[model samples]
Target: MTPTPKRTIVALAIAATLALAGCAPAAGGNAGNDSGGGETPTAGGTLTYGRLASASDLDLHTQITANNAFAIDKIFETLVSFDEHGKIIDWLADSHEISADGLTYTFTLRDGLKYSDGSDVKAADVKFSLERNLAKAGPLTLTAPIANIATDDAARTVVITLDEPYTPFLSELTSFASGVMPTDFGGKTEEDYLKAPIGTGPFAVSAWDPAGDLNYVKNEHYWQDGKPLLDGLDYVFVADDNQLLQRLNAGQIDAIEQVPAANAESVDGGSATTLLNSDSWAIEQIFFNTQKPEFADKNVRRAIAQTLDLPGIAKATTFGTARAASALIPPAIEYSAADAHDEKPVLAHDVAAAKQELAKSGYPDGFTATMLIPSGNSARAQIAQIVQESLAEIGITVEIESIDLASFRERFKAFDYDFMINSGQSDAPDPNGLVTFQADPEGFSNSYWTHYTNPEVTKLMHEGRTTPDGPEREKIYLEIQQILAGDVPYIPVYYSPNLHGTTAKVHGLESLPNGSVRFQDAWLDAK
Candidate 1:
């Protein structure tokens, strides 16, 4: 589960599906359409994936990291699946319905689904998997909404109750954390089950070497008809991004994600391999520790937010792939009715306005503080330098400090900092998770860093979560965005672009809005 924050805790790492102005595709852009007629499907080839980190285990309910999710997603079946745009749809389940009151959900399973071990899946297993997920360390914004779960084996039905109405509740089921396992295999702690996990998925865990390699073979009885074009998958763990890129270039691995921003330019322009680079559903931010006396007043935060040139930073940071992100809920998420998100500038660049606010903040002469960034991310380091210079223009001297990813996370969780250049991926595919998490005093959400206790933010987040109607939910979220634009808790810098490298011979590998790869209908062809 812990693969060193593959959650794309990017300096600007992310993937998502909101239609923003000038937004790139999650798959970068469609390449190899020369075969407009399409090519014949070929099976029996093995796809070796060069992963960003090693998987701790394949147990979904216990650990769901970005690294393992790529593995477990194929090995375990989720109740729902997300589309190219990150909207939730039925997968293992034939259909689902939420109550009008927005507190209960009913799902009917697809007929004849079976575990990789050939065991028939029952509704009881659905109840167990979800309840187990709720019992785990998965994000509370996604889990806390669920109050109860019940099963009816005969009807092949699963019923779920929520403590409150949550708009993204349905989408949350797409996670492998909600992956179903055989009821007979239920007794093992997620640790023991890692030894042998049985699920209704396209692939089965054939071998696991934790630090070396993890292999997955096609489930002979895979429910989908003629699906999973590849015979097997090999996830070779290569923690170093440079090595991963080199391996892909050398044809050592069939594909790789998280291509280093430094190497993206040459790779994207070269003919050696296919480059899929697109906008991701993540936002990198420079957060102000609101509790600190220097930033206790919101005006200082606003001053700093407006001083930075966000567009320039994004272009310079992610090799011109990631764009300037202006909102907490990035432009790639579904914030507008037009399949786009409005990144209303809460504090767009205006040095005069910034100086005015700084003066009002009782820091007209400016102040000195420290900005923490996780070591080893070039994107973050570059952006930090830019921010330091921007703040200096407004009279704030930010001493940039670099710490390891683990310690950075530790310090961030403790809310011990003056400011930080940090990022997070959306666990729940909807905006509710990040919007509310950032405002709510939940330490896990890192909202505590802002020390923001706005009742309006909390109320709108609740309304946006619970409201069942789309139009109504839209109004609530827009107001919430409007408020956040003015509040200046954190200044979003950019939306991390999803950059992927694969052999030009490979086709149909979907770059899901979450920046995940799915090779279900993929095929290999002659070079």
Candidate 2:
């Protein structure tokens, strides 16, 4: 949840599907040749996964959680993909060219591609997949500037016309929104499709256990040969991360994501498997509700921000893979300037200063604030407890409230708490998402919590959206970061590490931004 001035909040009413277009996958060109051309006995086995929670929907357009993304990445290939080093690489589309003006991008579709339903997937399908989100006008939309999309009648090429220059366009396209889906193939309604979606990737959803499990089977006619090596895939929603770890150690599941940092050492010490770590494209921050008296004052917020031990939190909550963050954009973003001060957050332990600020405010006697957190998120709960103790030292009382994951998210959306811990993931480093916190209706509706507003900040946010690349735009974003730091509307926590644990027998698991997992090339070795 983020804080914003409620009065100035404007909602951009674009289609929900359109919001995900910025992160669509690169077009997967033709890959029709059968692998090894032989009557190989069907390879099938059940691979179980530990999902953090049950997803609200499975429709590619509506699902963005780590568990759903893991399944989707296997079923749908994007036009572009990120390498292990976070660099862009080709995936579905053969090659792409952007006009010198950066407003027009043309994609050459791959030939011989067919949907699981046996319909030819042409450039038009790609265009539809890219634009459908905008047509749906739902909650899952991307916050970039796109003018229009058109595909040639031959269905072999797609062209995108942007309202303005967008340098990070491809990066945003790597999301599920841009994934091509067959039109009205089954009797499934749009809502049903989202909850139990279909796709053209290496596997398809075989069975979904609404309360506890999901399963996927290999596509006999998958586009790529020798793909989806596992016989089948399973995702089990385990509310407890500790239980997930225990299951993994007991050989019930092959992998689990985001092991609690506190228990990571234990997992590492056990013979279960190796703990994988990578730089994540997400930031975990403690957001302040500026709309309320509890955190309305910047002085109080800054004192709180300056008081915590970021390094200590990183070690205690996220293990060694996370680092203290000072800016919205993680260091992995290539465009950040070397001299940017906002990017270099203040990391200090000054409890005395914190106390002085508390004294200056009317709360010299210290007041209690409510903390809303997801009930089963072990990592967040641990971090909140740490924060509770830290703030108590400065005469501030934090009342922790843990609720169900679904209810917790809804509350955050509604700005129903004084403070909370959450994460914002970035596909590529850009300030466009800032609109969600600062812009009107389409932005964080919960901005009402902060009661923070600045026409200048709003103007700069629009500028960043409209001007994808330019010296002026870069300067504005840097300034925006600085302003945010000074405002102290959000307390900088640590950027969590994207960690994945895999048994040695499982091969070809790749890490993506947002703590997502991709397994196009994965295969199971016989135990």
Local error of candidate 2 at 447, Å?
A: 5.1
Off by over 4 Å in 2: 1-44, 67-70, 142-145, 153-155, 184-188, 335-348, 428-431, 434-452, 468-473
lDDT of each: 0.69, 0.63
TM-score (all chains, Cα) for each model? 0.84, 0.85
User: What TM-score does candidate 2 reach?
Assistant: 0.85
Residues forming the 10-long window of minimal summed lDDT in candidate 1:
4-13
Tell me, by lDDT, which candidate is best. Answer: 1
- In the range 75-112, model 1's lDDT, one tens digit per residue, is 78777776666655678777776565666678788788
Residue 252 error for model 2, in Å?
0.8
For candidate 2, write residues 317-416 as lDDT tens digits: 7767687777665666543432364445542468988788777775678788998888777778988999999998987889999998878877876778
Clashes of 1: 11
